[model samples]
Target chain A: MLYLIGMGLHDERDLSLKAVEALRGCERVYLESYTSCFNGDINRLQEMLGKEVVLLDRKDLEENPEENVLAGGEVGLIVMGDPMVATTHSDLVLRAREKGAEVKVIHSSSVYSAIAETGLQIYKFGRTTTIAYPEGDYFPKSPYEALKENHMRGLHTLLLLDVKADEGRYMTVNEGIKYLLMMEESCLQNQFKKDSKCVGVARLGGDTAIRYGTAEEVIKEEFGGPPHILIVPGKMHYMEEEMLKAYEV
Target chain B: MLYLIGMGLHDERDLSLKAVEALRGCERVYLESYTSCFNGDINRLQEMLGKEVVLLDRKDLEENPEENVLAGGEVGLIVMGDPMVATTHSDLVLRAREKGAEVKVIHSSSVYSAIAETGLQIYKFGRTTTIAYPEGDYFPKSPYEALKENHMRGLHTLLLLDVKADEGRYMTVNEGIKYLLMMEESCLQNQFKKDSKCVGVARLGGDTAIRYGTAEEVIKEEFGGPPHILIVPGKMHYMEEEMLKAYEV
Candidate 1:
C-alpha cells in the first residue's frame, strides 16, 4: 500500500487525525523531504507518529528509491503540506496505481487558499507561479509576467516562493519583493497598473502566520525569512479594501 | 476571542490538532449550520471535541444573535469545513474584528483543493463558479457562462454547487450535471472543441469521495448525485490524461 499523507503548514501537530490514523497503520513510512520542510523539526513528528520515517529526496523520486521496500510490507509516502499540492508528485500516485499498489491520499493544509489570510478574494487569483532559480539579473521573470497578466485581466496572483531546502536557500520575503520589483522594471519598464496595492503573506497555516500589506512602495520595506508569497491584486471589491485596513500596511 | 476553526473533510476525525486544541478551550461554540453539513452527525464532533455546540443559521449573521453569546467570553466559531472556504462569511470576521475581537483562523482541509480528488490539475482550473438559485427558465446561467469561458481558454472550471441550508437546498451532482449538460449543448451545438469532456466530483474530502470520469461517453450513460461539482477540463497534460485512465471512467 502506498499512502500519501500531508504534514500541513510547518508543524507536526497540524497533521489531521486521519493522517495520524493512516500513519499508524503503515508498516514502513517514507517522507518526501525535498519539496518542503517543517516549521518545527522532523524529530517531533518522528516521536509523535511513533514510527521511523525514512527521508526521500528528489533523487529518490527520479530513481525510485525504496520502490522495493514496499514489496514485502506496507509503505506510507508522506508529503509535507498537502499531498496533492504538487502536480509532479501526483504522477507518483499514478505510478503506484500502475503497479497495482493500493493508494490513499491523506489531505492537509496548503498555501493555495491560505491566501485568504490576506483577506484577498480567493476566486480572483489567476495561474499560480513560484520564484525559481535565479540565473541572471532576475529570478522570477516568468512569475512576474504571469502576475502582470493576471492583474491585466483583473485577477489576483499567488506567488509561491522557491524552496530548495537541502541547498539551504529558501527565498525570503525581502529578497522576493526586491527581485519582483526589479523584474517588473525590466519586464515592462513603466507600463504597469497600480502596483501600490499588494499583500505579503508569511508562515501561512502556522499559529502566528502573518498577512499584511506591502503594496508597491512598502514592499521595499524589510521582512525576514523563507516561505512568503507576494500578491498583486487585480480588481478589489470595496469590502476587500476595508479588510486591508485591519492589516498593518 | 473568536476563532473560526475549520473541521476539514467529512467527520470529526479529520480535525487538525490546532482546531482540536481550540475546540477544547472554547467556552461556547456556535456552529454555522447554513454553511455546511458534516458527512456525519453533529454528535460525532460533540463526542470528539467533548463540547456542547449551538447551531447558527443565516439570521444569526444578519441580526447578531451571537452578540451576547461571544461578547465577554472565550468563543469559538466552528464551520462544517474550512471557515474561509466560503468567502460569504468573511464579513463575520470583519464584523468581529470591528468589536475589538481577536480572531484567529485555524486552518483545516477544505474542498477547494480537495477537489483535486478528481485528479485534475489545480493550475488548469480557471475562475471557479457556483450554481445559483434555479429561478424560472434559468438555473443560474452565470456559472454556465463562467465554465464556458474557462473551457474556451483551455482551462478547467470548478463548479461549486450552491448551498442554501435555510431552504435545505444543497445542489446535488445529478442536478448540477443536468444543468451543465444543457448549457454545454447550447454552447457547443456544433461542438467548438474536440469533445465536451467533463468530470463529476462527488463528496470531495469525504472518505467515500469519488472522481469518476464523465468526459467520456460513459459518464453520460452512468450519471449519479448530492454534494458534488462538475469539472470541464480544458487541455489535458499527458500525465493528467494517464492519471484519469486509472479511474472507472
Candidate 2:
C-alpha cells in the first residue's frame, strides 16, 4: 500500500488527524521535498509520528517511484500541502496503481485553497500560474500571459512563487513583482500600469502577512519571508472591495 | 479570539491536529453548515473533540454573525473544507476583525485543491462556477456563461454542485450535467456538444469515484452519492490524458 499523505500548510501539527493515524500505520515514510515549502522540521514530524521519514527529491519520485512503491508493507509518501495538487504526484499515483500497489491520498490544507485568506473570492479566481526564477536568458512568460488573460476575463489570478525547497531558495513577493513588471515592459502590452492594484500575501496558512495596494505601493513594501503569493485581482465585487480594505496594509 | 477552522473533506477524523487542539481550547464551537457538504456526523465530531458543536445556518452567519463573533473567549467557527473558500466566511473574518476580535484561520483540504485528484492540472482550471437548483423564472445562466468563457480560453471548468446543507439538498453530478446541457441548448451556442468529454468526480477526499467520458455518456452514469463535482476539461496535456485514462470508467 502506498499512502500519499499531505502534511498540511504550516507545521507538523497542521496534518490532519487521519493523516497522523495513517502515518502511524506506515512502515516507511518518504517526504516529497521539491513541490512546495513546508515550514516544519522533519525531526519534529518524526518525533510525532515515531517513523523515520526519508526525503525524496524530484528525481526520486519523477524518475524512480517503483523503488518507493514496491517497498513491501504500507509505504507513506508524505507531500507538503495536498498530495495531488502537483500533477507530478498524480502521475505518481498512476504509476503506483499500474505497479499493482494500492494507493490512498490523505488530503490536507494547501496554499491553493488558503489563498482565500487574501480576501479574494475563491470562485472568481481564474487559472493559477507560477512565477519561476529565470535561468540565464531562458525566462518563461507564461505566468504573465496567464495573468493577463485572467484579467481580460475579469477574474483574479493567483500567482504562486516558485520554490526550490532542497536548494533553500524561495521566490519573494518583491522579486515576483519585479519579474512581472519586466514581462510587461518586454511585451509592451500595457496590461498593467505602475498604479495597478495588487495584493501580496506572505507565509499563508501560518503567520500570514497580507498587503493590498497598487503595484507601485506593493512593490515598495516588504512582505517578510518565503512561500509568498501574489494576486492580480480583476473586477472586485462591492463586498470584496470592503473585505480587501480590511486587509490593506 | 475567533478561529475559523476547516474540518477537511471526509469525517470527523479529517480535522487537522491544529484544529483539534484549537477546538479543545475553545469555549464555544460553531460549524458553518451552508457552504459545502460535510459527510461527517456532527455528534461524532463533538464526541471526538469532547465539546458541544453548534450548527450555524446561513441566516445565523450571513445576517447575525455578531452573535457568533461576540461569544467571547476563543470562539471557534469550524467550516467544512478550507475555512475561507466561501466568500461569506471571508466576510465573517472581516466582521470579526471589525468587532475587535483577533481572527486566526486554520486551513484544511478543500475541493478547490482536491480537484487535482481528478487527474486535471490545478493550474489549468479557470473561474469555478456553482450550479444551483433552478427556481421559477430565475434560472441562472452565469455558470453556463463561465463554462463557455473557460472553454474559449482552453481551460478546464470545475463546476461545483450547489448544496443547501440546511435544507439537506445536495445537487448530484447528473443534475449538474443536465443543467449545463439545458443552458447550452437555451443559448443555442454549440459550446458543448452531446459528445463533448466531461469528468464526474464524487465524494472527493473520501472514498472517491471518478468517471471520464462524453457528456452524454457520463450523464447516464451513476456517480454514487452526493457532493459530486463536474469538470468540463479543455485541451488536455499529454500527461493529463494518460492520468485520466487510468480512471476512465
Candidate 3:
C-alpha cells in the first residue's frame, strides 16, 4: 500500500506512531519539502526513522522524476505538516492514482491547530497567508491582501513566511513585520488609513518560543526569531480580549 | 513549570518525544477532557507515559471544584490534537502566572492542515465553526452561517464536530452531515442557494480514514473511523479543482 504520511510540525518526534509505521513498512519513503518547513533538518529525521528517505521535492513531483518511486514497491510520500495541506501534493496523489497505486493517508499534526498553542483564539482567525521572500520585481501581495481582508472583517490573519528547501532559509519574524509595515506604508501613501494592528509569533509550536504583543511598537520589544508568523487581530470576543491581555508577555 | 503538551491526533505515540519528557518529569499531569475524544483511553496513555494522569474535565477549570494540581511541582496539561487548538489554555497560563508558576508549551499536530492534505487550498479557508449535536431547543445556525460566510467570500469553511467529554460521545461525519443538511434545508427555506458542496474527512491523521467526497455521500458510505472533519469548498483555485477531481473518492 502506498501511504502518504504527515511529519507534524517541528522535529522527528512530531511523527505519529502510525506515521512511524508507514516509514518502517514502506520499501521506498519520500519526504516532500515545498509546502512547509521542517524545523529539524532532514538528516536528523533520516537518522530517527533509521532510513535514507528519498525526497520528492517540488520539481520531483511536478516532473514525476523517477516514476518508479510511486509505481514500484510499497512507496510512501512523507510530507512535512500534512501532505494534503498544499494543492501541489494533491497533484502527486492524482498522478499516483493514475498509475494505479493504492494510496492512503496517515495524518499528522498541522500548524493550523498548532497556532492555538500560542494562546491565540482559533475562532478569531480569518484568512491565513504566507509572506514570501521579496523578489526583485515581484512583491509578496498575498500576505498583505490576507491581512487587509482579515482587518476589514475584524478577524485575525496568520502570516506564514517562506521556507527554502534548497537554501535552508526560514523567514524571520522581524522580516515579516517589516513587510507588513511596508504594505501599510504603501496603503497610507495611497490615501488609505493604516490603523490595523498586528501580533508577531516566533518559533510556533516549539518550546522557548515567544508569543508576545501586537503592532510595530509592541513587536519591537519582541524577538527576531525565525520560524515565525504574524497575526493581524480583527474583532475580538471578550474572552479573546481577556486572553490577549492575560497572555501578554 | 506548567507544561502544556499536545497529544497529537491519536494516542500516546502521537505525542512528540518532548511531550513525553515533560509528562515524565511533571508532579501532576492533567489531561483536559472537554476538548478531545481519544481513540485510545487514558489508561493506555498513563501506562505509556509512565505516569498517573488525571482527567481534568470542564468543571475543574470552568466551575470551582476546589482541587489544585498546579501547586505541587511541574504541572502538565495534556491536550488532544495540539495543546491550545480547541481551548485557550492561555487563560490557565495567565492563572498559573498569577500564581507565579512558569509555564512552558510543548506543541503537537492539529487537524487544521490535514484538510489541505485532503487537497483543499488552505488560504481559501474562512473562519471555522464546530457543529454541535442536535438539541431540542437548538436549531443551530453557527456551522451553516460559517459555511455561508465562506461561500459568500469565495473561501472554504472547516467544520469541526462537537465532542462530549464526560459521555465519551463524538459527533461522527454522518451526524455532522445531517447537521449540515439541516442547515442547508433552512438556507433553502430562506431562498438561499443551498448548493454548497462539502468534503468530509474521517479519522484525520489516522491509519484508515476517508479524506474526500461530499458529506451527504460520505454519510452514506461506511466510515468505521475515529475522528472526522468536513471541508465545505467555496470558490476553487485551478489547482484546487484539479485536486478535488484527482483525490475525490
Candidate 4:
C-alpha cells in the first residue's frame, strides 16, 4: 500500500489525524520535498510520527519510483499541501497503481483554499496562475494573460509564487509583483499598475501576515517570511471590500 | 481567542493535530453544522476531543453572534472543510475581531482541493460553480454560464452540489448532472451532453466512490452517500486522460 499523505500548511503539527494514523501503519515514510517547501523542521515530524521520514528529491521519486517509492512493504509519501494539486503526484499515483500498489490520499489544507484567509470568496477565484522566476530569455506571459482574463470577468486571481525548493530559491511576493509590472510593460494593457490594489499574504496558517494595499504600497511592507502568495482583486462586492479593508496596511 | 478549525472532508479523524491542540484549549466548542454536513457521528467527535460539542445552526451564529459565537472564552468553532472558503465564515472572523476576540484559523482539507481525488489536475480547474435547487420558478443560469466559460477556456469545472444541512437536504451527483443537462437544454449550447465525459465523486476522504464516464453512464452508478461533487474535464493532457481512465466504472 502506498499512502500519499499531505503535510498541510505550516509544520508537522498540520498533519491530519487520519494522516498521522496512516503514517503509523506505514513501513516507510518518504517526504516529497522538492515540489513545495516544508515550513517546519522535519525532525519534529519524525518525532511525532515515530517513523523515519526519508526525504526524496524529484528525481528519486519520479525517475525510479519502483525502486525508491514502491520498493516494498507499505510506503507513505508525504506531500506538502494536498498531493494531487500538481500533475506530477497524480502521475505518480497512476504509476503506483500500474505496479499493482493500492494508493490512498489523505487530504490537507492547500494554498488553493488557504487564500480564503484573505477574506476573498473562494468561488470568485478564477484559474490560478504562477509567476516563475524568469529563466534566461524565456519570460512567459501566460500568468499575466490568466490574470487579465479573470480580471476582465470580474473574478479574483490568486497568483502563486514560484519555488525551486531543491535550490532553496523562492519567489517572494515583491518579486511576483515586479513580474506583473514587467508583464504590463510588455503588453501595456493596463492589467496591472503601480497603484493597483492587491493583497500580499505570507506564512499563512502560522504567524501569518496579510497586507492589503496598492501594488506599490504592499511591495514596501515587510511580510517577514517565505511561501508567500499574492492576490489581485477584480470587482469586489461591498462585503468583500469590507473584508479587504480589514487587512489594509 | 477564537479558533476556527476545519474538520477536513469526511470525519472526526480528519481533524489535524493542530486543530485538536486548539480544541483542547477551548472553553467551548461549537460545530457550525448548517453550512456543510458532518458524515461522522457527533458523539465520536466529542469522544475524541473529550469536549462536549455544541451544534449551532446558521441563525445561532449569524443572527446574534455576540450571544453565541462570541459570547465565550477561548471558543473553538469547528467548520466542516476549510473555514475561510465561505464568505459567511470570514464575516464571522471580522465580527469576532470587532468584538475584541483574537481569531486564528487552523486550516484543513476542503472540497476545493479534495476534488483532486478525481484524478484531475487542480491547477486546470477554472472558476467553481454551485448548482442550487431552483425555487419558485426562479432557476439561475449562472452555473451553466460559468461552466460554459470554463469549458470555452479549456479549463476543468468543479460543480459543487448544494447542501441544506439544516434541513438534511443534499443534492446528489445524479441531480447535479440533471441540472447541468437542463441548463444545456435551456441554453442550447452544447456545454454538456449525455455523452460528455465527466467525473462523479462521492464521500471523498472516506469510503470514497469515484466513477469516470460519460454523464449518462456515470449517473447510473450508486455513489452510496451525500456530499458528492461533479467534475467536467476540459481539454485533457494525455496524462490527465490516463489518470481519468483509472477511475472508469
Which digits, one per residue and each the tens of the lDDT, describe model 3 over residues B84-104?
A: 766547667767767777767
- Scored by TM against the true chain B, the candidates give 0.87, 0.96, 0.88, 0.97
Q: Per-residue CA lDDT of candidate 1, range A1-249, in tens?
A: 777787777687888888888888889888876787667677887888898878877877756643633453577777777788788676777777767777777777777766776677777777777777687654547777667656666887777778888897787666566667667677865423345566776677774434455445555555555566677677888877777777655
Clashing pairs in 3: A84-B116, A84-B117, A85-B116, A85-B117, A107-B205, A109-B109, A110-B110, A154-A234, A154-A235, A155-A234
Binned by DockQ into CAPRI classes (incorrect, acceptable, medium, high), candidate 3 is medium
Q: Can you write out model 3's per-residue Cα lDDT over A167-197, one digit (the tens) per residue?
A: 7777776677777777767665321123345
TM-score of 4: 0.98
Question: How does residue A155 of candidate 3 score in lDDT?
Answer: 74
Docking class of 2: high
lDDT of 2 by residue, B1-249 (tens): 999899888777889988999999999999887778878898888898899999888899899877775557789998889988888887787777777888889999999889888778989889999888998988899888898899898999999998987788889888889998988889978777688899999998888999998888888888877789999999999888988886775
DockQ of 4: 0.86
Ranking by DockQ: 4, 2, 1, 3
Model 1 residue A125 CA deviation in Å:
1.8
Model 2: what is its DockQ?
0.84
Which numbered prediction scores highest in TM-score against the true structure? 4
Clashing pairs in 2: none
> Compared with the true structure, what per-residue lDDT tens digits does model 4 show for residues B48-163?
88989999898988897887779968899999999889778988988887887888899999989888877777878999999999888988888889988999899999999999
Candidate 2 chain B: worst-modelled 10 consecutive residues by lDDT: B65-74
RMSD of 1: 2.7
Off by over 4 Å in 4: none
Give the higher-DockQ candidate: 1 or 3: 1
Clashing pairs in 4: none
What is the lDDT, from 0 to 100, of the residue A144 in candidate 3? 69
Scored against the true structure, residue B223 in model 4 reaches a CA lDDT of 89
